[model samples]
Target: MQTMRPNPSRSDHKAIALMYLAFFVLGLVGSMTGPLVPALRHIFALDFRQAMAAQWLVLVVIGALAWPAARLMQSWGVFRLLCLALGLMAAGCLAVSFAAGSGYFASVLLALAVIATGTTLLQVAGNPLTTALGAPEKSHARLALAQGFNSLGVLGGVHLGSSLMLGQDAAQGVQLTYGILAVLTLAGLAMFLCGGKAFPTSALANETAAPSEALTSRWAWAGAAAIALYVGAEGAIGSIMINFLHQPHVLNLPMAEAGRASAKIYWGGALAGRFAGSWLLTRYRAPRLLGLMAALACALCLTVAVTQGPMAGYAALAIGLCNAIMFPTIFSLTLARSKAPASAVSGLLCTAIAGGALISILVGEMADHTGLAQAFLVPLVAYGLIALFAALKPAIWPQG
Candidate 1:
């Protein structure tokens, strides 16, 4: 592994700013296709299962690749790794554009999976980088702030992509959308390469611990499971919100309007809550905060499931606020207890992102069978589990 020696006297502000910028852009890239999921489903005449599967495929690839990617980040400098990932994102977008334009839905979906692979790699590298950018005691807060920027990116992505691609046929509006994303990713890549040497590397290197060591930590494995459930529930709610609103008993809003609502109102709550949690973490204990958030999330999900009309839909949106801090809080807490293998342990936790794909798909399945409102129940289970972990702080991390 390359040794990272920072010049303590030099200003790291520029490097930190650039790193956050990279994270924000990654968020945008990940979310740009969100509102378009339903549109793509319609364009390809896919069923609910198939559409959900498409999204799942992307997440599964990301989860599968996260640990290996983390090792690569340690081997390569953060800048080079970030740039390469961004380039992959751009290329994936371009590839998807061609696939969509050429009328190959499967190929387009696969291309999207490729894009997610890049985004996942960037996220795995970026989180720890941001934590190292500031004081160790407040690393959790800094990470939350960084994630807040990620939320902003998601907001921007939804608006831009919706305006360009939401209502159009797959080929008509998608090409331009992907083109714009490709350009953004390319720009990010160039900037990262230009300033690659400035950012500091994290000290929690996993090179010493064999991959099996990461798997051996029970807390890490439990944490990974927690993350998976959390993401699955979050993704399911976020991804299907528009569709749910379109149902007869729910918001019954126009598709475009509902998409906007999901992005701005739903994710907007997530953004605000994360920023607030960043500050709050300075004053409170991690386990306590996580437990409270998890409980609130459970209540909100229940409310959404039982209520009807805009009230229920809005409640679902509000749940985003409760969810905002859970990921980072759980992450920091899990790593804090790891004896000497945080990096590898972190890798195990990251793999839980597969929950996003699986949980969301289950929600979609329920929506298909029962009603859109009932899908909220799927996330209810995940939130309850997170709450359990918060209270118990279990040790179930896996070994290689």
Candidate 2:
């Protein structure tokens, strides 16, 4: 699994194709959990915090390990690491299929953490590998196209996993779904392993450039904080959406209905908004557009927190649309302002993913103490801060 060399061969193209498949598979598996929050609570007989932890522990592991595993990808080739990641994911799925009893919830979470570790490694190896796949000029384009498959996967994962795994006999359904996912992962592993000469390791050291100044800029740190908040808010909102949507005061929808809406309305908004944000950003200032979206998201969060009914549910779901372009915008914005190199800025941003874990715990606690409605405040303030950052972009950023 050496670094890829210049003038990628036909095999390199195959590897890239399969890599998109890998992304899709990862998304499919990840989406299955959020919609199951209520069912998970009942099956495991756990409190709100523990049930949330059951789903969130994986994110914590990903945040903790993604960066370190990325560094390890230098010593180990990207392809090899990807294989390891998929293998571990398959192993976790298999473990879940077997660990079906009431008390085995902890074991299931541990398995999920293993899967998360694999996923983090896959992302670390996969993103850069896309850039290395072919011509340097087309790297961003290639990555964007590959990411589209990820959205499709998410849509499919939630909708499909919910239909199959959230039935009356949930334990058996979960077992069967996990079993199938295990099989699919193994199939992906086979494809990558057979990608002979597709990802042969070549020199990557010279390819990465790091400017020292970006690390020193205060705005770089600010941008990183915004990223943390953004990711945290996204994950926090998404994790609670199923339960929230099912609340008597919220939408009061059935689990399956809530799950479908979560996938279609929530995740779908992200898919559509990415396309819309691209055009909107082209017509407007980046910072200004970011600010506008964040403010809208903030308003929606407040609406959701204070109101009750279907409209409020939709408002909550609409936040995903606002989130669509944020990560790319924030990443680019931070890079623009930082004296640090693009690579360094990227590394710093990944650390912010830990926000998903920390913020979830905070929101979970809030929900336990108060109610889900009030827990909305956590992300509400987070989006407000992001809006503020976007509005103050000129003052906080260096003047060229």
Give RMSD to native, each candidate: 3.0, 3.9
For model 1, the run of ten residues with the poorest summed lDDT: 1-10
lDDT digits (tens) for residues 11-69 of candidate 1: 35677777778878877887754676777777788767677765677778878988888
Clashes of each: 12, 7
C-alpha lDDT (0 to 100) for residue 257 of candidate 2? 84
lDDT of 2 by residue, 319-396 (tens): 888887676567556655565544444555665567667777888898889888788899988889888778765565
TM agreement with the true structure for every prediction: 0.92, 0.85
lDDT of 2 at 394: 55
